[model samples]
Target chain A: MSSHDHHHDHNHDHEHPRLSELQLRVKALESLLVDKGLVDPAALDVFIDTYETKVGPRNGAQVVAKAWADPKFKAALLADASAAIKSFGFEGRQGEHMVVLENTPKVHNMVVCTLCSCYPWPVLGLPPVWYKSAPYRARAVNDPRGVLADFGTELPGDIEIKVWDSTAELRYLVLPMRPAGTDHLSEDELADLITRNSMIGTEIVTFPAKAQEAAE
Target chain B: MNGAHDMGGMHGFGPVLQEKDEPWFHGEWEKKAFALTLACGGLGQWNIDISRHARENQPPAQYLDNSYYEQWLHGLEVLLVEAGLVTEDELKTGKANGKSNVAALPADRVFKALQQGSPYAREIAEAPAFKPGDKVRVKSMNPPGHTRAPQYVRGHVGEIVMHHGAHVFADASARGEHGVAHHIYNVAFTAEELWGADGQGGAVHLDLWEPYLERAR
Candidate 1:
């Protein structure tokens, strides 16, 4: 979703010491690896580029759009998410075991790794800094509605909020409800309307026209 | 090891540090740490679980103080030493004393390996203990080692909604041991059950292993 807003969190202010020492430790480890030739610098560069530039939230958006369009695919996705996602070549790493939670008009779904930053890497790529931050991890489970509100997503009191706590063994991906008045739009355009936060359950996917109307 | 990494339901780390335009890798060192960790992982010396334990098992004070990537770097060192890829002396001195046994990841293969990521699922013949729609209580034992069960869920009852065939148990897998496959389930817990009636009442769904639960009386 949005960056974890921590202005009101007073506990964090007194915790977490300086980091200059950690920087030196990382530097030492890298130098050792380079000297040993165990890790080629060029290869390391390729690794970083692959994750940062190649894999991303766009992959998850495509899956969501396809599910919205095809009922069969949606059933298959909810049945066995790992296989359905792997069919799209989004398999591996933090996403080994996936469970897709469908969001309906009565129920909303959100995800947070309470223990650690266990996110679906192949589909959503690496998690945003906020997903891994201390406050979001602690509060997402305790105050999901409040967390969603911070992201500017307000739901009716009647709709139930369902928060999923991700773990190393399994990862959760939220399939958000489709926005109305865009039945004629192509799948590509529908995918465009989906934001990373929408799939994370903090925000909902609204059509461009609707977003503009709300802005006005 | 009940380390700081277990943040569920704990208070006081302020709002998520939102970035308007957050660039990957806040600095070059973070990039190096990320790449190096991936490169070392490519050697097949350890599984993802081990890497997680290395990070999670850190001394509480150190774990809380370090940044995210800094934790990654710290975990990498633990793996290198435990896997015998490097010695503590080498890490401290930043020197390679002898010829290496582990082959470096070739640049050309880096992209391919990343694309063809390894899957952690394994085949298990034993039937699952609990079934969907069954009421169960999360085991309350305070394990001395790494665990996926959170502090809040232990002893609380929930309903099993789905079964994810079989996968490696992270508790054992984190020690570099595999084949301890167990059925995983999506257990649904009510908001009021987890944090009393004062909480914003709703539901919380968690992917829990069969071992973490017992039939609720």
Candidate 2:
């Protein structure tokens, strides 16, 4: 099955003619729930808006940047991730308990929920489709390097790839190492250098072009 | 339930497809599915563990065929029916037989509800069974209900790296009971220990609760 495409050739018992079967099913379910006073449609709107627009990896980037800029915060983040993260007002839902894995020269950390799509929703937002897909869930633990390679990341032979399988309530986020030649940049600029994948550990933070020039 | 959801270390699936700048919801239906699940969950009829079990309890063939959101939608339907809030006939007919007594989660409360998420960590009077640096084996048992222990580490020995205080036990929670509190730990397993010759030169860490573990023999 193609993980990217939602379209499948399942035999439908009934058809809407215009809408897909799944779409029609959801609409019917929603209408039924609303009619029964089981769920508020307005509340559903808020739920969608929260994840779709509000919370995302930018929150994680700022956390990483603060840790990079302030050693005290870094120590606190490493020590108690939940409280340190809550200082930024980004704790709730799937991210009640948190752990930050620091990637260093000797070790690279990657997070995966082998059982289901358990992610740090407060910091990193909802997991990307690839992270939740069967292939990733199956391979990440047994073949960390291979999974990294799929994400276009290749580490040195010596760097130990630590695969964190989030099997319980504690959520994990990778604190990617700051790239070289980024010391001159401000924390905000440093946050700009961090990508969603970087904090996810599939990609490493890299020196921006301006920072590279400034270093020289 | 040893189902398709326990996919770690398995094979035959294709490469991990990474979409550039992937959106939160792939389709409008997915958004509805996600929101509906969370909103219905707020009704307090079922816990997250029960919800998870609903998703994982599907037949392997059916579970593997459905998308992530498809699975969520399926699970939500199952929960609604099991809770007596809805019926299969009502779902098919697209009509509610009667109104629900539970108040719907209001729009204004959605933000606070999400921001202050339901925490699973529980206070237990008992001390942790094992300490850091202690070796333990994941018990090899196929539980008929919900469990957080993954299949790959099931019979493997690992060292406890850190002890996370007591948390809700998922297996008990799936049965709609207030879960039994168990001390959780971060167990570290070498790649070689998990996958014999196919093992990569790395390590895997899993957050395991007390019930899933025993002293390594």
Candidate 3:
């Protein structure tokens, strides 16, 4: 029964004064390092720069794309996800026990980590800031329909929405159904249709041709 | 000190302000500082001894000053410097240059890579000890350190829906600060089993580790 309260402000004046000393020490140490010139600030800068520009959920998207293209692969994916995923060559932390949930006309899947940020890092990379936020974790389980509405996803009442809680042992990634008008595309072309938001069950993969033709 | 997952009870920790649409790394230094303090306190003697007593004995305020990620960043910074990966000066320079030593990669690429092959491509191993449709009970016991199993769902019984390959264990106590072996599984449970009649209306499934479960009768 949760309703959207977009006006809610989570920040309040509950500041604790105890951390001032620690904050000062950190600032002082940072200043000392800058003065010493032993560190190259550019390295940290480049790291952030690279992540924003290059690293993200492309791997997850590729997995979804391959699943859509090959029926045998999709069957294998649903039957033995971890092994099927390995056939494509992805691996990393929290990805050992990979499970692929298909979003169909009757059933939709969404993933959340109520314990912590237990994500499939090998596929989805680091989770988005919002994924780890408290509001998302709480509302996702309590009022899933309302939460999905916030993300602009309106599910039909007849469709059963399954919200899966990711614990430490197993991690989840959603394989959203392929968008319409993508029947003739190749696997590589299909890969571009997937989005990170789709894998998280927030949005669907939209056809690029529709947008391109509309733009004209 | 409190557990790492006890973040919800902290003040000003309910939701984030939507209007503050700043860059992702806003207040980066503050976050790092918070993580360092928590790690020092949570890791206890192990961290302090390694740090040569650099961290003070007093714990910081529960959640008022910095967010959890900030604390995580801070902890990483301290550990990296301690491990001689980078220095305090290097961290500062990285910050000033708008870079982070540890930045996440693109989700799409990461997912693509994972699907390309098994993560442990170098070490080929045998299949898992269990299979689908097996009745298993999640292990019930509270260890003294970080665990992947949530307190609410411990000891619950579920069916083995899928068998994921080995990766890293989430039980930090057994695997040291960071776990080594991965004992992963997808366990499906009926809502009634977990929450009794209240949850009987629908089914609730879970993905758990092998160590977290035992063969259920």
List model 2 lDDT by residue over A1-216, tens digit each: 002123223332242333488899999999999999999999999999998888988899899999999999999999999999999999999999999999999999999999999999999888888889999999999988888777667788899999999998999999999888888899888888788877878777776522321110
DockQ of candidate 1 against the true complex: 0.52
Model 3 chain B poorest ten-residue lDDT run: B49-58
True contacts kept of 3: 0.17
State which candidate, 2 or 3, has the greater DockQ: 2
Local error of candidate 1 at B217, Å? Answer: 2.4
Worst window of 10 by summed lDDT in candidate 3 chain A:
A207-216
Clashing pairs in 1: A3-B18, A4-B15, A4-B16, A5-B15, A6-B15, B1-B145
CAPRI-wise, candidate 2 is: medium
Q: How much of the true A–B contact set does each candidate keep?
A: 0.70, 0.88, 0.17
State, as a TM-score between 0 and 1, how close model 1 is to the true structure. 0.91
By DockQ thresholds, what CAPRI class is model 1?
Answer: medium
- Candidate 3 ranges beyond 4 A from true positions: A1-43, A72-97, A157-160, A169-171, A184-193, A206-216, B1-24, B27-65, B77-130, B165-167, B172-183, B196-203
